[model samples]
Target: MLSGCVLAGWLVSGLPALAAFKLCNQSYDVLNIAIAQPGPEQAAADDFVTRGWWRVAPNQCATLVREPLKTRFLYVFATDVFGKEALSGAIPLCVGTRRFVIERQGDCLLRGFLDARFLEVDTTDQSDWTVFVSPRPS
Candidate 1:
């Protein structure tokens, strides 16, 4: 379980905002994060492509999607070094024990992957967004 972790999102400020999806870790320990987005053929396949295992250290940030935002929503899941869930949500997605890029969701166990709940982030169609992960209030 997450021992007091909070995830928040916002846009970065600059002459021209960086067009990318980023996550900043303010938690107390290292974290492994995953991201899920609509598949290239989402309209026809109605599926999502999930990628993961970005090792983020405390007080640092990682650029998950290094391009202009194309989707209004993105899903995220993260865990601490000990495999304890640090951030999650209602969206169930598929993940793997090692680095992976799962092409679809559901039947995780049968598909040789693990089922994980991901927090859905609404970017409000912003071109650039940053998610800050920090310790929850005591």
Candidate 2:
């Protein structure tokens, strides 16, 4: 009987560590961010596969691991009044509710809250985005 109680205590203590969560909010309004890594997990080490994991309205407080369909890994975009291409000059990058694009890949949960953003991406293919995070900007 004492062993059973001790075992329960150990299990309860580990629950806190497993319940941790996080969000990634770059701006006040919602913004889409895709943490992508080129290559396929199923493919062999010698080969490569281009894939992306995306999330709509990824907040600074986001840390929960979502499924493949829930998150994306491709080019996730946020638009102002200009639409998805609003990233052309940064001037139109308004804040507020906006549309979202999602792409599924092996239970969407691309990596985690990366500590950085400035990356030298070869391209920004806005093809994987289908889900609209919002209607439009005000």
Candidate 3:
């Protein structure tokens, strides 16, 4: 039989690492953050859902998704504290000026909303992922 200490060590080593999705702000100015991930009810009728508005202060970090990541892809959008665009990408995603959860991406103006470029992050199906938001270089 294995000793108590040996058994404990083995068990600990066999356990999986903590899984989470986190955002880190590495800029001087405060940032307004948003995220989009897979949504429930993926029936033929209902489709993917995306939500946002997680504010992150300068030199801070926020946990966007506390549980283990369920999707391989994630979308992100962020702006400065002054409502000026800070970071964006070519991928277009439906977003609002205020806190919102869009069911799908399309026709922002018709839906009474604005369009924002959401950067896509590929997590490679990892259980944990962290995204760092940095200011544009002068």
Candidate 4:
């Protein structure tokens, strides 16, 4: 079960304004980015932007909107914080007008393979992601 597919590495190469940006699963896999954050919406309200790059179907794969968190997920090497981005982009946090408070828990990394069998997911597999969340500036 853990040795069938290779967890595709997603490279978010797009406009940086998309703070809460989501990447397309290159290998057409759907996995939960179990965000170890606060509660809900804080991440989106602060630095979350959605990036739509699903090449299969509009309803295929998972997007930020579908993420357990209400923001976009970016892939990093280890630990890297997102700084102030000064670009003009409109990556809506919600599809309509449901403003969600992004969840911010660990100001470090999000480790743990989401259970696929128990959770109905897009990338229904065991994939681990590293979320580099930095401290909010005072």
Candidate 5:
């Protein structure tokens, strides 16, 4: 089952904001996050690009993707500093022990990576999006 992490999205108001994908850590502990999306050559290879290991402090936000959002769906997986699963979902994705940029999914162990289940976040075609990771309820 997925943790009680909350995910919310909204457009930045006021001045024009740069298009990007961001995650906010509202939990009491630091979080390690990873994200996956359709790769640039997805249409040709039907693959996904996953990257991760962003250490986000409590109450802080991190920009996972610094460019314009291209896809409507993004997969995310997060764990606390203790290495306990904090947020996850039904979709399986490949992740690494440290900072990594994996080009494809499946056969993670064979490829020298770990397999993780990531929560799917639908951006609804927004240009910029931020996912708020709230603390799991007591």
Candidate 6:
């Protein structure tokens, strides 16, 4: 099963707003989650807006994107408390040694970031979306 929570609000009073994108942790173990999307302002020049280290307890959820889902592609990298990576696949992205929000990806060494494997998620051009982190069957 998957559990998630979403929040939406306006930047100004008396104005409609966009729904947020959420990530739900359906797995039994707690997860440290990372999210990447296009930068709000800088993405026109940069490629991505990367943020990480959102701790999601089991059966709970976290808001990854607080604004309306603008991009079709989202990236995620997750790990458990014991340092076990909680994702599959070999798609690599730039990550930092600690919690970070990098303006872009690529040139990890020259840019002083670590390379991590992020699974790609296609949102299908929805205004809002949820990623359910289900348990890995044993």
Q: What's the residue-level lDDT of 38 in candidate 4?
A: 22
Local accuracy of candidate 5 as per-residue lDDT tens digits, 1-138: 225567778665899899999999888888899999998777744288889899999889999999988899998999888888888888888999999999977788999999899898999999799999887566
For all predicted structures, in order, the TM-scores are 0.90, 0.26, 0.77, 0.21, 0.91, 0.77
lDDT of 3 at 132: 74
1-138 per-residue lDDT for model 4 (tens digits)? 111222333335555332232333232223223222223454443343222222222123333433333323332111111211211122212111122223222221232211111111222222322122222233
Best-to-worst order by lDDT is 1, 5, 6, 3, 2, 4
* Clash count per candidate: 1, 26, 0, 19, 0, 0
Question: What tens digits encode model 3's per-residue C-alpha lDDT throughout 69-108?
Answer: 8888877777777877666666676777788888866677
Off by over 4 Å in 1: 1-7, 44-46
lDDT of 3: 0.69
Clashing pairs in 5: none
Candidate 4 accuracy as lDDT = 0.25
Task: Give the per-residue lDDT of model 6 (tens digit) for 3-59.
Answer: 222222223447564577787887888888887776667435447777888999988
lDDT of 2 by residue, 91-116 (tens): 11112232222222232233221212
Clashes of 6: 0
C-alpha lDDT score of every prediction, in listed order: 0.86, 0.26, 0.69, 0.25, 0.86, 0.73
- List CA RMSD, all candidates: 2.0, 17.2, 11.6, 16.7, 2.1, 6.2
* Weakest lDDT window of 10 consecutive positions for candidate 3: 1-10
The count of backbone overlaps in candidate 4 is 19
| lDDT (C-alpha) at residue 36 in model 3 | 73
- Score residue 50 of candidate 5 by CA lDDT: 87
